[model samples]
Target: MDRIRRRRTGAVAGTLTALALAVTGLFAGGTGTAAADTRAVPQHAVTGYWQNFDNGAQVQKLGDVQDDYDIIAVAFADATGTPGQVTFNLDSAGLGGYTVDQFKADIKAKQAAGKSVIISVGGEKGAVAVDDAASASAFADSVYALMREYGFDGVDIDLENGLDSTYMTQALKSLAGKAGSGLVLTMAPQTIDMQSPSNEYFKTALAVKDILTVVNMQYYNSGSMLGCDGKVYSQGTVDFLTGLACIQLENGLAPSQVGIGVPASPQAAGGGYVFPDVVNNALDCLAKGTGCGSFKPSKTYPDIRGAMTWSTNWDAGAGSAWSKAVGPHVHDLP
Candidate 1:
């Protein structure tokens, strides 16, 4: 189809996946994302970020939630710090208005089962742009307010473009304190230049790594800015992420504090699906069984603690699921 790339609205467009299928009565298509299901690699215990690239089945997903994982972050930034004047988009109602109690219950249940739940703030377009650190802090505080009100275990800082994290690092650590329960202070920093540091990302990262629980480098996005070497070379399926890991380590982030970013869709595509498109494609491939396919997480980044997806719903359906892909590599960590 020439990959014409239809420019969907931020919401619609951002939701698109490389596994690309228009859903002709529930069907699957693509190659690397092959079908029917995947032989699930071991899911990492370090995973906690979950994007809100879902529609409808969100409650069902949470309803069936188990705590085999370490962290569980939901997509969304606080609306008060929104772009322009929009308000209240990234909230509990993201999928199906999951109540605060329901969310708390999910967190508690998962915690009981040994998992952690975090509220992800500032997605690709949720709110917050990296124009300056000052703006980023405003956005971070807005998100912080929401976390406190809802009694969340923590918050994920994913300010993709609009505000330089340098301005928000202090705010992040500060907000991290308000996140509660020794709240995990995770941050998602973009890779800018290695020679020195664009927007002083490395120094900012090091400054906050101690207070930060995890710093997920959006690998693919990081590669574009940092260089394609991570994907084009290295030992893992996506060398960019491997390189990113190195960068984080060099910047003072511990392996346990750093995680490779794998979204459900391509950033070039529109910054949607925080999960692995490979897993999405693989599930659809499994559902349709060789009808069409794309990629799978197991076939992608085969190393590290594991991987994180945007949400639990994108893994929905009678077949082709994110959870299924967690089987083989579930015990990836020590």
Candidate 2:
């Protein structure tokens, strides 16, 4: 299988809605307009991707998503014909006739329940590019527009193709300026993209560290990588999760800003699928220095953000086993 054929199985049309320039002074700051009312993410949270197109996994409306998932990332916002522009098309027909108005209402319901619904851009086949300043502006403007149109709390950068740290950092900062402090910025860089602080993805994470909510690096599809201790660890093991996470914790990311992302099931990725117990063990090892494999961190990160999965739909297909086990564990972390 191709490395880039991991998540997002089908394509959806990019439909950009015309956003009104109307501003309501509901809150302060952010470009002289009221900021978005983004819900506060938990100290230790669970993030899951909600698939837009049916791909054998469970097809769900935004409201039907389980409460265990603190952050519901709507997967694969399509890259538009314009450079760096993206738009979301709800697969109403494919999703059993789910409509745009219903989708927006569901997003509001999630937020009211203290869950964040963010638009995830870029996947295995994602080709959205923000390489230059002009494209960077377009990217930020379009994403912010989506946030307003769809009632999204923020944006998730899952661009697998490639990224320019300089412009991405600028784009995110510009977005935060418009969205205000409530912006919930998150990322899902591949394991290789974050092996070192010098890498583009890592650089962008560090650049926007203050505004960044979490960097849930996809710990699957990554065969083997060097840990912060400079030891090579293979995937599908506790060492792979804890060891690789140490790199981010030790390098620049705060304990609260680092998260371990794993596949929801064996079918979720090409490889690197660990059971819920293994994920729990990794979390324990990182947070409290217990349940570890061979490699262990020099220090414990009690405030480590938490865990994430490729999708919630897969967990539902498996009777919600992933979230049923991992969700409480993440919330119960000390």
Candidate 3:
């Protein structure tokens, strides 16, 4: 998969017309199924992005991904001619000729197993931006339509180049209105994106903290970033993971809202991929205050959501080494 490099990178009900959506708050009237959002936003969770293309990595159906992965984020949905205008470009040829309906059926199978599958936007080369209200609305409408069309549980924001906090917030708020209860909103910002609370991505996540599910900051393909202790930490270390994650946990996000994002293997990213055991050590140091590697969180985040990886395809290539080793560790986190 040729992903855009800055890093990486939902639906609704009727009676949920735009007008009615406007008046309702984010968590307004939701059915039992809407509770899907709450469960989808899991604790001690393991998330993996599935490449829509073959990319030399194993291509598995949505329902065939490892059982330990709680959330499976589909690689990307392209933004069309206009800013925020978007459409999915699933290459049936690349997908082993899996038809759209087959893909949709697989998505339903995943949901039946209690896993949340969502569409991820942006990659190393993704072109998506929400600079104003109109663009924001276009983003909301287009993404919502994809959710309804594909039976997706939500959307993941992985815009690598840049983002507009203000309008992106507007678009998400509008999207939440449309998605109502089951809406799952997640984010995958680069290491620098979370170095401070004021950065565009950080601001956007904080702005929608109420409706936001999780913010999985990509810790791979990054060189160095400022930790919560106001010092810089290089990648590929537990300090790098927990310290940067501390910025979000202490700044505003609940423990459950922050997840440590990394690459499944060195081949999965340009740089900064650590061994699975190292990833688990970082999780332990953060969630339980043990396994410290130089820098430790001032306080443990027992409720930290868990970990996220760049691509599940790469994990399969490694004989599922990454998920096999890390998934159970994340699940056993304090």
lDDT of each: 0.43, 0.83, 0.78
Q: For candidate 1, which ten residues in a row score worst on lDDT?
A: 29-38
Clashes of each: 50, 0, 5
Instruction: Looking at model 3, report the run of 10 residues with the lowest lDDT sum.
Output: 26-35
Pairs with steric clashes in candidate 3: 3-124, 4-123, 4-124, 4-125, 5-124
Candidate with more favorable, higher lDDT: 1 or 2: 2
- Clash pairs for candidate 2: none
Residue-by-residue lDDT tens digits, candidate 3, 183-242? 888899887677656679989988888887788888877666566665557788888888
Q: What's model 1's lDDT at 89?
A: 40
**TM-score of each model, paired residue for residue:** 0.60, 0.89, 0.89
lDDT of 1 by residue, 164-219 (tens): 54566666666655553365655665443221223455556656655656556554
TM-score order of candidates, top first? 2, 3, 1
- Model 2 weakest 10-residue run by lDDT: 15-24
The candidate, 2 or 3, that scores higher on lDDT is: 2
RMSD of each: 12.3, 10.8, 9.8
Ranking of predictions according to lDDT: 2, 3, 1
Q: Give the runs in model 2 whose Cα sits over 4 Å from its true position.
A: 1-38
Global lDDT of model 1: 0.43
